[model samples]
Target: MITEEYLMQKLSRTMSEKLLRHARGVADTAEKLAKKYGTDPFKARIAGLLHDIARDFDDNEMLQRAKKYNLTVSEYGFAMPLLLHGPVAAVMAREDYGINDQEILNAIALHTVGSEYMSQLDKIIFVADKIEPNRKHAGVEGIRRQANVNLEAALLSCFDESIRYVLKMGFLLHPTSVKARNSLLVDQGSFRK
Candidate 1:
């Protein structure tokens, strides 16, 4: 397990502070969700902390890192710059940061453009990222409320919102996001509201 101090040291000063605070917020949210759903708090915290490790990087740098780490960048990622960060972050988290845990890496990789086989930690980070305290959106408060009530329901809401937002912006939806929604729908019986 990488120490928090070591993780902070690896980040740039500005990114370190911002990511640390965000990580803490995600951790808090993750812990709450984990407790509610009977998942592991420690795993949730690690997933939350590392989810955005590549968020601060620019498009060119992100692609470079992705290539360096031999991450299989999807066509969607190539067309849409925003989607590249998560998978790139996963690779960097493993190769650069020496975090070899597959579950943690998968959580980071799929947090943005989620996948079909998302683990519990993946769901925790995905929902936590959307509902973290600093996030302000039209229905974020409602989503957070739903998260408190039911984690699966919260994820359904979040995934629906994410897809709608992406389509509204005239961007191509990553297939992984669709797969995630389908998987969740199978688990939760479709998104509501």
Candidate 2:
């Protein structure tokens, strides 16, 4: 099994100190949520730690990595280049880092633009990335508080914020994001809203 130390070493060498610390914070938050939600802590840790692995790479590097992994680059991913990092990192984690777990890869892949069939670990990593202690935003506190009570609800809140932000910024919305929101809304019986 790949150890946390190994992952940390790789992360430290590739990312700036600030980004590395953020990754660690996300890992810690993911572990806490995993314990609370009865999810696997190991998977949560890996997902959180590697969620932003592609951030340090430039656009060409990101695209190369994505192509190397056969990830389809969508119009939304192109417009919002940061969105490609998640899926690219997922591929790098598996192909380069030798991470063979599908759940972990999926969690990393969908952290940015979540999908309808996200697993518990996926939801945990996604929420942890958005609401880690170091994060500051207008409504972050509310999402953080909701995470403790209802993971799904917290995801809904986070996705809603993301959607609003994208719309306000005039960024193209990813279809996966919309599907993710719809999936959560359906689960909450608020799909019509």
Candidate 3:
């Protein structure tokens, strides 16, 4: 098993200072949510810490990394390679970091643009990345508060904010995010409570 120290050292070497802080914040928040939701706190922390491991890559580097890992990219991913960082980091966390745990990898991969029927660890990482202490936004507090009550509701709230930000900034809306929202709202009946 890879120790937290090893992961932290790798993160320190690979990420910029600002990103390193964000990763720590996400890990802290993920662990807290994991405990509250009765998931594995260790897995949550590891996924959160390594979720942004590939975030510093430039466009070319991002593509090369994806190719190296045989990870497919959509047209939007090619246009905005930053979005592929989650997938790329997932690959790295497996091959480079010797993380063979599927739950951790899935959480890291889906953290950026979530997928349908996300596992508890996946939801924890996603919400943690969005509502971590370093993050400041209009609806973060609401999501943070909701997180304590309902994990799925917090995910829905976070996705709503993310979609709004994408529209406001004129960024391409990834279909995965839309599907994630739809699944939470419609398929999962997440808001029924």
Tens digits of per-residue lDDT for model 2 on 65-154?
Answer: 777788888877666677899989888898778799999999999899899988999999999999998899789999999999999999
TM-score of each: 0.89, 0.95, 0.95
Q: Which ten residues in a row have the lowest lDDT in candidate 3?
A: 184-193
Query: What's the true lDDT of residue 114 in model 2?
Result: 92
User: How many backbone clashes can be found in candidate 1?
Assistant: 0
Any runs in candidate 2 off by more than 4 Å, and if so which? none
Q: Candidate 1 lDDT, tens digit per residue, 57-94?
A: 87888778878878787787678766878787787777
- Candidates' lDDT values, in order? 0.81, 0.90, 0.93
Off by over 4 Å in 1: 12-19, 190-193
Count backbone overlaps in model 3: 0
True lDDT of residue 162, candidate 2? 92
Candidate 1 lowest-lDDT run of ten:
7-16
Clash counts for the predictions, in order:
0, 0, 0
